[model samples]
Target chain A: MLRNTPIKRKLTVIILLISTAVLLITCAAFFAYDLFTFRQSMVAHLSTLAEMTASTSTAALAFDNPKDAQETLSALKAEQHIVAACLYDKDGKFFAAYPANSPTNNFPTAPEPAGLRFEGSYLVAFQPAMQSGGLQGTLYLKSDMGALYERIRLYSLIVLLVMLGSFIVAYLLSSLLQSQISQPLLQLAETAKAVSERQDYSVRAAKLGRDEFGLLTDAFNNMLEQIHNRDLALQEAQQKLRQHADDLEKRVAERTARLSETIAELEAFSYSISHDMRAPLRAMQGYSDYVMENYGEKIGPEGQQYLQRINRAGMRLDTLIQDILSYSRAARAQMDLHPVDLEKLLDDIIQQYPGFQPPQVEITIEKPLGSVIAHEASLTQVISNLLGNAIKFVQPGQTPRIKIRAEPRGDDLRLWFEDNGIGIASKDLNRIFAIFERVHAERTYEGTGIGLSIVRKAIERMGGQVGVESELGKGSKFWIQIKKS
Target chain B: MAVLGNILNPSKEASNRRFTHRLRACLAGFIFLLLAINAPAQISREYQLKAVFLYNFAQFTEWPPDAFADPQAPLVIGVLGRDPFGAYLDEAVRGEKINGRPLIVQRYSGIQDVQNTHILFISDSESKHLLPILASLQGRSILTVSDMEDFVPRGGMVRFLTTNNKIQLKINVNAVKAARLSISSKILRSAEIFPPAAK
Candidate 1:
């Protein structure tokens, strides 16, 4: 509020008005005093003149010599301010008058009482002509009041000049005093405004003097410095947080890129392993069969049996390689799950293989099986593996009997494939899902024991879960749970 | 006097004092005589001073109106016997007016010739007739002055005396008061005022 007011004008007005009032009062008092003194001295001087006139005219008035008295009164002509002077005989009548130019004839036709009086513009005094014995007559003097007025005129002129001088002096002094305060205040205001408007805390007000304004300026500057430092600290903290975020992002990007490279290299190794191992196995099988056929009679029955054994081992090794490849592919491939008709898919699998054709193996799917969320190829692969496992792991003198059905379970569809087969023992249930492991002896199984593991891996990759319930003499029921679309 | 002495002597006081002491005696008379004899063409400065003294005395003494023929009449100083002050007195009083009256010097061979005069100077030529001159002017406001020795003691109003070779005043206040005139105290202070001597 104070900042907005023009301090110089306010202070100057306050000081100037007060000083002018005081100066005018003082000058008026002085002028009044001087005027009073001038008037008093003028009266005193005229009184002296009256006394002198009376004394000198005593003899003339006593002797009744009007001429001498007139002459005595005429001497006052030398006194410029004495307009007229007259002498009154002892009879108290105007007798001898001075100067034909008697200012006015009203020089009191009758004698005035003895004393001095101010009459309009004149100072009239009455004095008795005194001798050693008695009163000779009265002397009347009328002096012009202009003398005192002259003094007043001079004093008035002096008063006017003095008033101007005092005003000028007061103005100059107020300017000097105001600059001491107002200049610093203005500087502080400017700096504070600059800081607030521009958010520039670096701006500082100047400390021009060791006064209150200076202290204020210092305080403002100090506050700005604190804000500037705080801002600097905040900026530093933000910079550090950003740097940390960037570092974190860079590390994550590097780790992700490295992980992708490792996955790609593993896929390439798996593919080559599957493809290369099969070729060599096929060549070995072909050579063994040729030996059995081309030199059957010459080698004898024992040699032919050993060669067949070698051929069977090669075929089993090739199947194991294919199982490994399928497991790796299921684990690494991106599978999109869609609703698949489990009934149709099972029927298609049966028709595609002669083993499931009627008398070879009994495969039954519950009619009108509902659809489920699953990857098309992976889901087919999984079901195929399960069917094949059922047939291969069956009890020795029984054809494989399989049943497929599905039921809704919460937000998911759980499908079950029940098969009449040599059931897995509860102890090997967890182990059954691992690769290259068989619950039964290899001679008893008659096949690689990798079908269930493949099924479990494929179902898991397609976002479905697989589990089994089995007994040693009865069949096993394997279930797959998938999210309902 | 100290200021005058110093002005005359920049370096020493002894010669200044001795020289002025010698000059004190008849300084006015000798100046008058030398100017009249050796420099006849020159105005006598000595009588000029005496003429001024006469007018100055008139200013201090108040006279009765009876001492003038009329208010318009001039104030007369009657030289009762010889006229010592020549044209110097007239020259000194030329165009001078005191109390609205001009001062005039009149020469008188005897007391009978003095009429309506405010002052009477008894010159040395009338020294023997001083008694009758004063007696004739008794009870009048005529200030009596003379250069005769023992004039104040002999009941004269003012006497010019030579003391320390300087012209000095001897006044008899009693005799002046007897003339019914008041002499200003200022003139009395500078004059050697005396009481009536033991008869």
Candidate 2:
């Protein structure tokens, strides 16, 4: 059975029909048995009565005092239960009879003693009688078997009547049982149909008994309860999800607003640095040019040198300002983390510096760098700064030997820039990474001291760590470790 | 023979109880019938089944040959007074024969008419006639049946009763033996056999 198909009606119908059938079969069997036995016993009794009457009617068959023989037989027949009697002669002829009655209008010939017996409205008996001359006659006597048959017939009729009555009763009972069970089952089916069609679960089945049907009803009710509970739970969960989505939308709106504000501030700050700062530098340059132009004849070489020094000082300040702006911008830059292939990046950066002739630098590059998750531009800046510093501080008369390698620490990428260069004094190593702090004077270095500081700031903004290793009169090695995320 | 012996020996108390029970059922049935006639024409199979059982029981029993002197004489079944079955029993058994004997039912007031009877059915209305009926029936071929207190011990052959408001029956073997009548064993298996009373 499918779980959905209700069987209460079918079950009740089967039980009632089976019970009725059993009852009918039992009654019919008994009726048939009774009919058989009644017929058998009636025949036996009639035969016995015929035999006894025949035995007593021997005198009538002999025709000795026929009147007395007839009277005796008549007396026997006169018994309240006896219907009629007759006597037959040995020649298969009628000799005397009782009650003056015959099943047929004419008396039937006496049957052969060895032949089959006959039965009808009369019950006849045969016996042999001795005559005075040693001769014998077959005596035949008959009595009505009507009453016996009538009794049996009446009994059979009564049984038939009873069977008919019981059948009607059984049929009615079966119908009643069918209705009682089918009504409830139909109701359940209708409710189930309605539930399926309308997708509603509110309807319930009525309990009819404590039988299997009743148990089924209870189960159905429980199922409905569970479905309703699950539905309620689902609704509650959906409501919670909706609430979470609304909260997320609110957070996204707030973040977008903050981002736009930050972008506006950056643009305004960049504009201020670009115009205001450059204007003063331009005026200083123009002033220095005027001084050189108007006082050229009176000025000695030292004076011209002083003017050149002033112009150079002004240009250095401009360059330093530009570097400061660049460093600040790199520090403030937002990161878009993605896969950065260091090998490809290092290769690209090194290619840009191909102008350095005799690229014979024994640069033992470790198995080219692998990809890491980081801000691609910021990570490239760190690498380029280190690589540029190594190229700049080369040992006199030594090939610019460099080794570039990478290592992963946890979720971070660590890169090493080792090179053969004019190593810094141990004491200056610490201060060299600070902004505007250089180991050699500006004249000898011919470079701003802001490179290492910018590198440190760039790495820090990208959530990374930077360090240096150096010994006076040896090459320096700089290392940077960046969080992969 | 065991069945007949058991049926011929029933206890006084059990017979009395059965008699009272039968009397009550007869009264209840009569009342129910009266109520039924006006109430509706619905068939009461329960009552009909009882009637059928009683009719069948008659078929299974045999009367002595002397019980009928003339073959035409009615096999009188006499009820002393107050017929309990009304006319339903009569109608059910009408024109019926048992053992080549035509059935006849009558109400008698005294023992003088009892000699012609084959069965003397003593209802509660004729309870007072018990002793006289017994005395007249002693050593005779008559089968005495009754629904009365201690009817079996008092020498009635059969007692009808009600249990759980359903019809039931009890038998007295001693009474049957005394009547010189042979009851069938099939009927005895179902009937509640009461032991003979202690003298």
lDDT of each: 0.76, 0.65
CAPRI-wise, candidate 2 is: incorrect
In model 1, which runs have C-alpha deviations exceeding 4 angstroms?
A1-5, A101-104, A230-485, B1-199
TM-score of chain B of each: 0.75, 0.70
Q: Alpha-carbon error at B70 in model 2, in Å? A: 32
Q: Per-prediction TM-score, please?
A: 0.38, 0.38
Clashes of 2: 30
Error of 2 at A421 (Å): 11
Per-residue C-alpha lDDT of model 1 across residues A278-394, encoded as one tens digit per residue = 988999999998888899878899998898889889988988888778877787778877777777777787788887677877877677777777887888888778877887877
* Candidate 1 C-alpha lDDT tens digits along B1-199: 0000011111122235456445543453575576545332222343444565676667667887677778778988778887767887888667777777887888888889988788888877787777888888888889998777767878899876544323456789998888888886645544577883566
